[model samples]
Target: MGADGTPTVMVVDDHPIWRDAVARDLAEDGFNVVATADGVASARRRAAVVHPDVVLMDMRLPDGDGAQATAEVLAVSPSSKILVLSASDERDDVLEAVKAGATGYLVKSASKQELDDAVRATAEGRAVFTPGLAGLVLGEYRRIAKGPDATSAPSLTERETEILRYVAKGLTAKQIAARLSLSHRTVENHVQATFRKLQVANRVELARYAIEHGLDE
Candidate 1:
């Protein structure tokens, strides 16, 4: 969230028109458009300054690809949630962005409403993705879980584990709270605790950990 309470956003696209349009839409939709960047270097520089709540990233940039930009930006602004807004939905691209710490992936074909909702969700720590892209990400994690290097992870409490399962299933804190008859704040606390215990930054990584450990089942 921004200092003014609305989610702060940074638009990173090589295309000037598209970048401005996205910034305008987000601004009109109640987001604080803190900054705009055209390439990886600018994205990292601006992100370091604004530390926005969400970054609307483009897959292709003047200097590098979205994966590179995502990584660089997060390296500077670790708390900023990245939401890829790419025209390509290729499996490799999606996977690269996710591995680079993108919290969500939305294609260019998404409606304005969809984009608005996705940005809001991303700011709130939810992992939003284009419909099929989510399954692709989760399946990749499951495959990685079979690897020998996936053995050790930090331990989580039983309650935290239960909450993690719901998170892996893509449930929001409010929804998980309703399911468990707990307060939303309580659910968020458990999620935060899980994040700390796993040393993961966001819900996307937490979900990946859960799937890797076969907790999503």
Candidate 2:
């Protein structure tokens, strides 16, 4: 934890240079910081040891993706929040990361000041996105508001829609499975189906859609 009672953070990225630099910046900004340069193994270890309040996890790693690794982290410490730090603007990748348990997302090339502020925002329990991407996240909300026919929305079954409501609430596949008395695989399938039907790319968008349409309630 920080001196101000702010939560500590763990920075995970495969790039040693950027990882160290980001860690140093966060430290200067008064965060208790732990950092790693490996994707799968190191990220897990760091999370286990630090149980950080916020995590700045890279989306891509040599051995695994940050999204894939987030589940492991959550299992160890369910209270920890994850924020993706990625270079890709690929829509599907963003959605998958969010669906996988990340609380927020950020793109690389963000200035030092921007990244610093983002870390603070996330630590304070707020969602953050880059400029253009915020619009994309907002669009999903609009799709729901304008109705299923307003956009290229696809039709979903009752079960799938139920799963989407959980997604909007930031529940993982396993959690949803347990809540609905379905298997993990079944929940994953429902998520994929929702992705296809909505003509949307990722969980983040789906979540916004659910919230926008009042599916979360």
Top TM-score hit = 1
Expressed as tens digits, the lDDT of each residue in 153-207 for candidate 1 is: 3456678767666766777767889999999778766654543433332323433
Tell me the TM-score of each prediction against the true structure. Answer: 0.69, 0.62
Each candidate's number of clashing pairs is: 0, 1
User: lDDT per prediction?
Assistant: 0.74, 0.66
TM-score for predicted model 2 compared with the true structure: 0.62
Q: Write the per-residue lDDT of candidate 2 for residues 145-187, one digit (tens) a residue.
A: 4664444444567786676666656676577789999997676
| Runs of candidate 2 exceeding 4 Å displacement | 131-217
